[model samples]
Target chain A: MPTDKEHVHNRIAVLRAERGVSRRDLATALGVHYQTIGYLERGEYSPSLHLALRIAAYFEVPVEVVFSLTPFPRLGSTT
Target chain B: MKGTTMEPTSRKQKAEALREESRRRAAERQQRRDEIIRATIDQEVAPRWASRAGRRRLVGLAAGLLALPWAAVVVCWYLAPSDTAMWATFALCLAAALGFTLIANPLMKVTRGVAGAPDRLLDERQITERLRAQALAHRATLALLVAASILVSTAVPDEGNVATLPSAVFAVFAIALLATVAALPMLIAAWRMPDPLPDDED
Candidate 1:
């Protein structure tokens, strides 16, 4: 049912890939365990908004650019 | 241009693979924990509409049952004045029985709801917090019961009347004494134990 947390964040992996950063380096930058970085990148856990923003900031991009709401619903014409 | 690939020894490759597998497992465990927490919160805080529907059904059932006794009490009161105490006692007993039944019913449901749930939700930190709070509450209740019992025993004389003091007072004393004594072992065990799982299975 998507229980809120399932609106996954692909941001970590996307940012890491773009910057060509290793998981260990990202973990060090994030001040979290390396496994945490791996978990974040795999979308196993959704980061809090604060963590999301921090990740986006680390990538030098807007939060929207880094994180996205997936299975994007189409905007219909207003009735 | 293709470069020559260097193959690593089996032992080194095996070690590297094992480390990667361990990291993967850790990540998976953390993810599972997060998912379980999210699900629990959702269940606990189900939509207001759903909760309201359930409450309405329960209330309807209760009201239907209560109507019969209420009607009987009103009729009996008008027809027979002498049976007031009998009816009152009957009502009180019914209420006590219902209260006890209701109390016991929810324990099983709550246990089922958190069945197979991860112990991380009730981690060592949370267990310690709960034990501390419970200890304080138990002490406070024990103190109150003791004071009440002493006051009742002193104020009310052991004259011809047996039911001079409130039955509730005696019941509270008995319950508190038993609870306090029973809790001693649990408190001691909890204090002595190191990082016990909140649930038995965990």
Candidate 2:
């Protein structure tokens, strides 16, 4: 279920965890504040298109892989 | 013979002491970083929504602030009944406005991202939230002022005292401006907070 009207869900936390990057470290890379990263991960705020693309570029992932309008599937789920 | 061996042992002891100092410094640095992280988490993990009590307190403070200038004006009108007294009331209200700017502005900048103070850089989300809140508050203030003006015009018959009327009007506008400035940021910030995250939910 999408919490915000923006409807832009993301895998930012998962990717950052997989890469062993701290929020501060990733925020530095993305040229944003650490709290901004927290807001994005928690769905409390949605990033601009420019920021979303920049974040995707930072993680070296396709925009679709990073964000979606629908809920992401749980890892290892049968569905 | 003992002296020669003692020299090498002394060198080893010096090296060991240096290593211990280096390790201690590293531990201290790590501890400092941990403290910073803890503080950041404390700030960021606060309850998103303001409590009922918090709202009441803020409204009370705002009301008190709004009352001050009017109270001064009334006192000046009754006690002195001179142009000088009116001027004094204006000065007092101006001082109150200045005090609010000095004390409340920084607080708002830090907590609510108000005033767009550069030192405390607000993220886009905070900036947007404040803008939305201020716009609503501004409209409300404008409407209230218009209604107030109409009521005052109807109630207070024109005595053709140009000097007194203009000053009174000026004082009213100044007080209104100060009240709006003092109340808007706090109201917006208080209203924008979200509920805390439950342990089971995000």
Candidate 3:
């Protein structure tokens, strides 16, 4: 089973692409480094709920649409 | 009357000055920590996620290593025939296990303390990054320990029919396992702790 760290799956890149937003633009909007945006998109780092909400807001989407706790799944319990 | 009033006023002024100085020193110390946190955060960003994973992996490795000596002791006790070789193997395994436990236990404690320092309250990113970096360092240490065990076991000859080689191999593995697994949860917990928001928010 994946650990808690892996629970928050981010679809940052997909959202950014869907919106035709460049990494620089997103980084600027988020007030973070562009590399941070890249890292977030790649799932190398998990964002805090605040950051997740911010990202979702930036993309004008629901937080769940941009992030999920479903794919990694909890260690136990089905569905 | 005027002279008596001036004396009290001067004493009050002195007390205020001392209080101000104490507050100033506290502010300076806080500023220093803020700078350190800033630097640590900047340095930690790229490597944070990788480090947490590393800590978990390392702890697991250490735990696995810890199992080796017991296995060796049991095997040696059963064989009974090769007394000299068994004793030597047992001693070596014990030493390795003890050495690893000693080093890893303290190392984990130190890391936890550093990660949990209240002075680190800064940007949330900074705290997260520091934790992640610590985890990565821990993982790297575990990897090194595993490699070292394999190397050392290979160097030791298998000439004696006393099961020395297996014991040594298992000892290394156990130590690595113990070190890795023991430190994993703590590292994760430290990493997962929420960073305090900026003072203005409070």
Candidate 4:
């Protein structure tokens, strides 16, 4: 059922890359297995509301910056 | 000069060394990713019973419950006064059914599902496997029932006295029915487990 729904595009991979954070490192910080981080990064899994908030808190960013229904704008590109 | 020969060979060797180092690092990264994936699957996919110590207790309880009725029936069959044996068998069956409803059912409630119901502890993939297994079990049961019906109907005498059939025949049929019924749940539960990932040959 989760798979049937539209994917919730995310900036997790970009954010992790910008921070130079490996999946294992992020997973450790979040107290989840590394593959869960990989899944989240690839948009294969949608995090629960609680987990989304936790991830945003971990990154020191707002939830909207991390996840969105639409694709995020390219970094440093003119509109 | 000797220097020209040495310089070209040295350049080729350096190039080869760089390629090897790159290949090794690539292999290391792939191995790390593989390990992470395996760990995640091992952590999340296993059923509660698979990793939990409480499975042993649950198994012991189920085995004891199933065995109790058979033990009673066997003791009654051999030890009871000849006249009471049949009545004892009937009584034992009734008692077992009562015990299952009153005791074992509630004890098993955590893992319990109606024949086709999804187990709460199972993940989506496991639930899919369980459903497939349940369907197969249903089909097998249906086949068995149909075969039994045909055999029974054919074995009945032309006189139409169903009671005239041998009691041993009925007992055999009852045992078959009981075994099939008992196995269905166990089959589905066992089938729900994911297969181990096959080793990569390369």
Residue range A1-79, candidate 2, lDDT tens digits: 1356657888999999898888878877876656668778888778888889998999998999998988899999988
Per-residue accuracy of model 4 over B1-202 as CA lDDT, tens digit each: 9999899999999999999999999989977865554443344322544432444444455545555555554545355545566666656666656655553332333233222232543333334445666688788788968976796577556574543543544563466368556755544444333223222221
Task: Rank all candidate structures by their lDDT, best first, as comma-separated numbers.
Answer: 2, 4, 3, 1
Error of 4 at B108 (Å): 23
Chain B structural similarity as TM-score, candidate 4: 0.37
Summing lDDT over every window of 10 consecutive residues in candidate 4 chain A, give the lowest-scoring window: A31-40
What local distance difference test score does each model get? Answer: 0.48, 0.64, 0.58, 0.59
When candidate 1 is compared with the true two-chain complex, its DockQ is: 0.03
For model 1 the local lDDT of residue B147 reads 81
Q: What tens-digit string does per-residue lDDT give for candidate 1 at B86-150?
A: 56535644664474345222221222222223445442323343455457657755785688568
Q: Please say which candidate is ahead in TM-score: 1 or 2.
A: 2
| TM match of model 1 to true structure | 0.28
DockQ of each candidate, alpha-carbon based: 0.03, 0.19, 0.07, 0.02
Rank candidates by DockQ, best first.
2, 3, 1, 4
For each candidate in turn, give its C-alpha RMSD to the true structure in angstroms. 18.9, 12.4, 14.0, 21.4
lDDT per residue for candidate 2 within B117-162, as digits (tens), equals 3323555665666677678778877886798678667755467753
Give TM per candidate: 0.28, 0.62, 0.35, 0.36
In terms of TM-score, the best-performing candidate is 2
lDDT of 4 by residue, A34-71 (tens): 55566566676677788789889989999999999887
Instruction: Provide the lDDT at A43 for model 2.
Output: 83
The model with the greater lDDT, 1 or 2, is: 2
